[model samples]
Target: MGSDEDAVLAGPFWYGRWDETAREHHGGHARQLNRAARAAHYAEGAFDPDATRAAIAGLEIPVLILVGELDFSPSPVLATQLGELFAPGWVRLVVQPGAGHHPWLDDAARFGDVVTRWLAGS
Candidate 1:
């Protein structure tokens, strides 16, 4: 697979919001320069629209859809729409303030707290 759409994915900083730490954590070093190609191959297979629809068709458990405030891939607006697909009373959507694609990587404490509260059924 090729990352022709985003050349940045071929380097240490795959996304604009990530810093050196995230790069290191995600193995962006020279040894893994080929990471992007592998990621590209899996990314397409990671989410199958038809499979997703089938999986969530009768989901009865609560769903928490969290995204970073600055994430545009599945923007806050889009996340909200996704929440709507679930039973209204069973969905909660949260956009972590000041974060990008990965809120936990950007603000670990806040991310932990948010998730903790949700898991506690707060």
Candidate 2:
């Protein structure tokens, strides 16, 4: 899985489908240097869950938390748990069905509709 096909497979793993356009786009734009930097950032403890919860609790604005139903790095359960840290009614958590990590890439129309409707009401 270390070849170009492996890179293409990432689209399915992330978006729930083998999106050719997305794969091609990613192939064109994904730089090794940027990937290295991102890997380093994650290794450096880019997120502290306790601090994140404390910070989100202090926010007064309405928060929309969107997560893909199939995303494993931070699963739907984790997303719900994060939303629970905020005051009731302050956070709206939406788990897009059939999606992995990139919900918009998995179902662009549905994603657009969800975001548009949420924006209209917010």
Q: Choose the strongest candidate by lDDT.
A: 2
Note the residue pairs that clash in candidate 2: none
Estimate, for each residue in 2-117, the C-alpha lDDT of model 2 and write its tens digit. 66677656645665665685575466645534867767777857788898878888887788888889987578999999888987788888999987777887788888888988
Model 1 has an lDDT value of 0.74
Question: Tens-digit lDDT track for model 1 on 8-115?
Answer: 464433333567766765563445568688688678578787887767756889888988777786888999888877755888899988776767877889899989
**Which lDDT value does model 2 have at 15?**
57
Give the C-alpha miss distance for residue 77 in model 2, angstroms: 1.1
| Model 2, position 37: C-alpha lDDT score | 76
**lDDT of each model, Cα atoms only?**
0.74, 0.77
